[model samples]
Target: MALLSVHNLSQSFGGLQALTDFNMEIGGYDLVGLIGPNGAGKTTVFNLVSGFYTPTRGAIVFNGKPTRGMKPHEVTALGLARTFQNIRLWNDLSVLDNIRIAQYHRLGYGFLDAVLRTARYARAEKNVDRKCRDILDMMDLTEFVEELPKNLPYGLQRRVELARALSTKPRLLLLDEPAAGLNALDVDGLIHLIRWIYNEFKISIWMIEHQMKVVMTLCQRLMVMDFGKTIADGAPGEIQNNPDVIAAYLGDGAV
Candidate 1:
């Protein structure tokens, strides 16, 4: 079964139609790329699916349920997670604390149970800590456990953001420009880490990116949009040869 589906999604900001009839289907374990010129509504689509914004019109189905008016955390509870193009982190918190927060719900006990530290509460806390540390290690951030978010370098900061997102235990991950502002080496590391996560967790990924090299390497299928509409969709190789894609990039005078 598909993990996520969006049909006839349309949204507008008064005079600006941000997305128009956007449609997609993502099956479990599929890694798809969403690439297009600036203002292509790629991130807007992510926002709609992630519940950051309610669409002006259309329907979104996730895990076989309607998601037209769900909240962001509600979406996360339904097995969807995402990272923003612009980094969002608790700068005052340690890297570990930031990531550890995501697993709080999995700890199971209510506040009273936690304060009491009953057997169930203790066990749940222990399990959460173990899993959080394991995820940190997976992101190659084991040594930075005690370091504040601001203490980490830019590349590591991005890694921390990714780690925080993964802690949500999502079935479908929407990554918005994950490689943005990353150096060459950091870009390579992100590529490896993302693939490993997909392999280890069996989660599907949908990303909005402009980096063709990374997109082509990480995704099996690619979708391109322009002016809030679907312009092209195909395999990486096919997308490269697509006339619409070429025109969309060139026609917009982007390249």
Candidate 2:
């Protein structure tokens, strides 16, 4: 069975339909890319799947369970985690705390235990600290673990956001425009890290991106959207030659 299934998902904002009859299926360990022009509703798909917006007329199934009314945090707890187009880290928080906070859902300690400083709570805290540091090391951000996000470079901040998303321990990782503000070198590094994480962690990745190079190089399958609908979907090479996709993007002057 597919890990994620979106059947005829649709969304609207005061009569402007953002997405219409959208459908997709993602398998385990897959790297899928969603791409299109600026207003093609690419991010809308991510928002719907991540539970930021309730769909207007469709259903989503994650890990064989229905996700109609689940809240964003609820969806996240169900093994779905996402990063935003714009970095959304706590500017005042250290990188360590930023990643640690996302692991709260998995911490098996009660509030009372935390307040009373019980042994179990102490163990959990130690585990969290160790895990957060380990993840920071993996992302090559251990040196910046004590620094605020705003104090880091743009690329490092993006990595920190990705680290926080990974801290959730998701089966499915959704990234929205992760390369938006990156330079060429940073984008190359981002691509390398994405592939490394997908392989090392063995997690499925679904991404919304405007960077064609990243999309073509990393994604095993590609889905293109335009005017609130899927224009084409296939392997990267096939999608590159798709006439509808070429026309939709070029006509919009997006390419």
Candidate 3:
């Protein structure tokens, strides 16, 4: 089944057109790449899907539900989660705390229960901790659980972000520039990590990235955007050979 669909999606910022006639169909557990030049509106599309922006016009259906006007938290509750282009970790919090916070949406407790620390709330909190630890293990973050974000290396910090995102138990995960500051080896680690995420969790992934090495190798399908419009969409091999994508990159001097 199609986990997400976008048709004729268009957005504008006053006089600047950001996205136009964007259409895509993402199936279950698909590893899809959204890419293009620097100003290609890749992150904008992620925002639109995650409810950061209401489209000027279009339809976005996630898991057969309309996403129009829903808030970001609402999108997450509906089994959609995303990471930012910039790492937004709580620098002071331990890595375990980061993932534990993401699971709060699924916790079964009223405000009064939290305030009073009821027995039920205690049990719920314990379960959340166990689940968070399991997620940390999956991301290879167990060793750093007690450490704050500031103490971790850049590459490990990125994995912590993914671990936190996975704590949400999302069916579809949107990753924006997950490999942003990594060196070659770190990027390769992310490629394997992402593939493992898809295979083990059965989660569909859609990502926006400028790193061709990771995007081209990791994603099964690729979508090219230029000037906020999708210019080409196909498999990795086809996209690498496509003249339009090549020209779009070179024309924008991104090559």
Candidate 4:
């Protein structure tokens, strides 16, 4: 079975129709890209699939279960985690603390256990600390564990956010514009890091990226969206040559 499946997905913001009849299926370890011009509803699709917004019409099935009414945290608990287009780190929290907080949903101990400092709470906290450190180390942010996210460089902050998402131990990772503010050097590093993560974790990755270099380098398949609808879906090479995708990005006159 596919890891995730969406059927007839649609969303509207009152009078503005954001997405229409969107459909996609991701296999167990696929790496796919979603691309298009601005306002093409790429992030909207991510928001709906990640449970940040409920779809106006459609069904989302993840790991063989329906996620129609699930909350964002509930979705994360079901092995789906995501990083936002904008960095959403707790600026005041230490890097380690930020990573630690993402695992709160799986603490496996009640408030009473925490208030009383019971064995369960102690064990849970220990495991969380170990996991957070491991993730930080894996992402090469171990030295900055005690530093605040606001104090780090833009690229490091992005890595911290990605590490926080990985701390959730998701089977599918959704990355929205990860290379948005990165410099050329940082973008190169990000491409390498993403490729490493995909191979190392052996998990499915679905990303919305506008950087042609990033998407073309890492994605095996690409889907193009324009004005809330999919215009093309095929291999990256095919997408690059597709007339509809070309027209959507460069004007009909260019086509």
- Local distance difference test scores for all models: 0.90, 0.93, 0.90, 0.96
- Which number leads on TM-score? 4
TM-scores for all predictions: 0.95, 0.97, 0.96, 0.99
Model 4 lDDT per residue over 151-235, tens place: 9999999999999999999999999999999999999999999999999999999999999999999999999999999999999
32-111 per-residue lDDT for model 2 (tens digits): 99999989998889988988888999999998889888889888989999999999999999999999999988899998
* Model 1 agreement with the true structure over 134-189: per-residue lDDT tens digits: 89988889999999989778888888888998998899999999999998888898
Q: Considering every candidate listed, which one attains the maximal lDDT?
A: 4
Model 2 Cα displacement at 171 (Å)?
0.5
Q: Can you tell me which runs of candidate 1 are displaced by over 4 Å?
A: 252-255
Candidate 1 lDDT at 239 equals: 94
Q: How do the candidates rank by lDDT, highest first?
A: 4, 2, 3, 1
| For model 2, the run of ten residues with the poorest summed lDDT | 246-255
| Worst ten in a row by lDDT for model 1 | 246-255
TM-score of model number 1: 0.95
lDDT of 3 by residue, 182-240 (tens): 99998888999998999999989999888998888888999999999898999999998
| True-structure lDDT of candidate 3 | 0.90
Model 2, position 148: C-alpha lDDT score? 96
